[model samples]
Target: MHETKMKPTINITRLQSTFDVSSSIGTTEKGGLTRLALTKEDVKIRDVFVEWLEEAGLAVKIDDLGNIYGRREGKKKEAGAVMIGSHLDTLPKGGRFDGILGVLSSLEVIRTLNDLNIETDRPIEIVNFTNEEGERFTPPMQGSGVITGNYDKEIIYKLKDKDGISFEQSLIDSGYLGDIKNRSSNVDYFIETHIEQGPFLEENQKDIGIVQGVKGTKRHRVQIKGKSSHSAFPNSHRKEALLAASEIVLTIDEVAKQFEDLSTSIGVFDVTPSVESITTEFVEFTFDARHIDNAIKDQAIRLIKEKINEVSIKRKVEIDFEETWDANGTYFSKEIMKSIEEAVESNGYSHQYITAPALHDAKFMTDITKTAMIFCPSKDGLSHCEEEYTSIEDIEKVTNVLLRTVISLANQN
Candidate 1:
C-alpha cells in the first residue's frame, strides 16, 4: 500500500507491473499494442484478466458479446451494482494506456478494497468491453451496445473482419462467449477512467478531467463525379472530380473553423483511375463532424452539405452525399459527477469539467444507467499510437479518485 497526503492508496507498484504484463501481450516493435478485438492476443489478455479477477475473489462471467465482468459482492447483493469499466482491445497500432488503464485501475481498486477488508452496501462490477476500437468490426462499442439493446446482437454476430472471420466465430475461438443472460443491466451507476487522449488537460496543467459529456459525432460519405480527360486536355474544358473533392475537403475544414468546439475531417479519400497523367472522373471521401451539441453538429453538417452543392455547381460536377452514422451528445449523471469531483477535491488534485472529444463505452452506458468518466492527462495529447504516454503519479491520482468514488457510490443509501 502507498500512502499519499496522509491517505491510504492503492498499490501503484502492482498496478504498474500488471500494466507491463498486459502491454507485452500484443506488443508492437515500437512498444505499442495491436490487440485487435477477440484476436489471439486479445484472448490471451482476457485470460489473464479472468485469472486476476478470480484471484481477487470476484465472480467472473462473460456476456454474449465477449464483454467480461467480475463482481465483488457487497453486504446487499440484491441492489444494483456500482460498475467500473472500459475497453481492452486496441487499434492495429495503439498506445499502451488508451483502453487498458481503465481495466487495470479498476482491478487495483478491487485489490485495494480487499487489502483493507472494506465492504460496501452494494456490489461492484468491473467490465472489459469488447470491440471498443472497432478496428475489425465496422462500428465500435459493440459489447456495451449489445448489452444495452442499442445494437442488434444477431447482426453484430454476423459482422466480419478484413480477414473474413465473423464476430461469433471469433468469440467461439476465444472461448469467451457466454450467455446473453450474463449481460449487465442492473447497474446502479457506471464509472470509467481513461486517458484524456487530447491536449486539453496537459495544456491546462490539470491532473484529471471530470467528463461532463461526450461530443456528438456524425459520419458521412460523399462522392463527386466529373468527366475524366487526357493529360493534354485543356484546363478550361476539364471538369475534374479530384479538384471538386479537394474543394469540399476545404469546406469541411472551413465549416469546422466557424464553430469554436467543432471538429471535422475527411479521413478517407479515393479517386477513380488514379493515374498521374489522367484527371480522375470520380472521387469519394468520408466526412466526419463532431460537436458538444447534436443540433450544432447537425447544423455544421448541413452547412457542409450546402457547400458541397456549391462546389458541385461551380465545378460542374454531380455530388452524392449520404450520412452513414449519427450519435448524439450524452450528459452523465450529476450525482455521480459530484462524487467524482468531491473525490478529486479530497485527493487535492487539480481537475476540470470536460466534454470528451472522442466517444467511449461509458457514453453508451448512459442510456441504461447513470454513467460518468474520469480522464488522466495524455502526454502531448497523443493516443492510438506509440507516442502516447502518462505518468504513474497521474495514474495514481485518478485511480485513487476512482477508488474513493466507487466506495462513495457503493455505500450510498
Candidate 2:
C-alpha cells in the first residue's frame, strides 16, 4: 500500500471558479457558450485546462486527435491508469454544464488529491475529449472514437465543416495538432461525470445518479424526390414530396408511440424550392431514434422503414434512407458500478441507478476499459440550451462522490 496524507474535502469554491472561467469563453447573448471543438474559443479553454493541470503538477499529454490527458503518477507506475473525464466542447448556444462539468469535476478530483498529497497503487488520468457535440462536425465523440479505434484517423482528419474547413486544418489552426500518435491504450477503469441532461434525478428527488448504461442511437438521412409543378395544376398529376415527407414524419411519431419505452425525434426537415406557388421538388430530413433495449430499437427502425416504403408508393415519390450512424446501447462493468454505489452510499447522498437516454463519450470508452458514469441533476431536466442549470450544492455532492470513487479505484489491487 502507498503511504498518503489524510483525504481532503472537495473545494466547491475552486470548482465554481473553474466553471466560471470556462463558461466565460464564447459567451453568447443569452449567457450560454458556443465553444465548438477546435474553435478559437475552445483553444482558449484548453489553455486554461493545461495551465491548471501543470499547476497541480500533472504531466500533460495530447494525442493526434487532440484528446488531452493529465497523468498523476502512482506508486505502481507499470499498472494501467484509472481514467476519468469527458469532452469539453459544447453545442452552439449550449448550456454551461453539459460536457464542461465532467472535465472540470475530473480536474477537481485531481486537485483534491494533490492537496492531500495522496498517491495510490495505480496512476490516475483526467482526460478531455474533443468534438463531443458534433454540432460543428458530423458524428460526435470524435476524440474518444479515434482513441478507441471506432473511427479511422485519416477519415476523421479529412472530415469538413460547413465552411469547407477540414478537421485536420482546424486542429492546426488552433495549435493543437500534436505529433503524438493515437492509440487504444490499456485502462483499468473509467468514469465520467455529467449532468443528467434529463429530469430523472430532479423528479426523483435524488442527489446523484449512478448510470447503469446508455441508450442505443441510430441516425438516418432521408431524401424524398418529386416533380415540381405549378400550384394551379390538378392534384391528380402532382408528386408532392413535402406532403409525403410530412406523412412519413407522422408515421414515425405514431410508430414510436407504440412502444412506451422508446424515444424518437426528427430534428431536421427541409424542403427545396419552398414557394407558395410551386410544389416542393425535393425534401430532406434527418431521423434520430434511441432506446435502452436493442431488440426494441431495431424493431422500431424496421417499422419506420416499412412505413416510409408504404408512404413512398402511395405518394408516387422516390424516397431513400441513408443511415449516418449507429451505436448500440452499452452497459458498464458490474464491479465498477458496485464501487460507485458504495461511494454514493458512503457519502450520504440519495442515489438511484438509471439508464442514460443521451449518448456520451463514455459509450466509446466502454470498448477499451471498464466504464461508468455519474450524473448530477439538471434543473427542469433541460440540456443543450442556455437555460440549462444544476445547483452548486448538487455539483458539490456529486463531486465528492466522484472523488471518493476515484480514490477507491486507485487504491485497489
Q: What is the TM-score of each candidate against the true structure?
A: 0.97, 0.94
Scored against the true structure, residue 160 in model 1 reaches a CA lDDT of 93
Which residue pairs show collisions in model 1? none
Weakest ten-residue segment in model 1 by summed lDDT: 1-10
List the lowest-lDDT window of 10 residues for candidate 2: 1-10
Estimate the Cα RMSD of every predicted model relative to the unseen true structure.
2.0, 2.1
The TM-score, computed over Cα atoms with residue i paired to residue i, of candidate 2 is 0.94
lDDT of each: 0.91, 0.89
Put down candidate 1 lDDT per residue, 1-413, tens digits, no spaces.
Answer: 22223454799999999999998999999999999999999999999999999999999989889999999988888999999979889998898999798999999999999998788889999999999999999799999888887899999999999889999999999998898889877889999999999999999999989999999899999988899999799988889999999888888899989998898877788889899889989998897898879889989988988888888888899999999999998888999999999899988999999989998999899989999999999999999998889999999999999999998899887
Highest TM-score: give the candidate number: 1
How far residue 27's Cα lies from its native spot in candidate 2, in Å, is 1.0
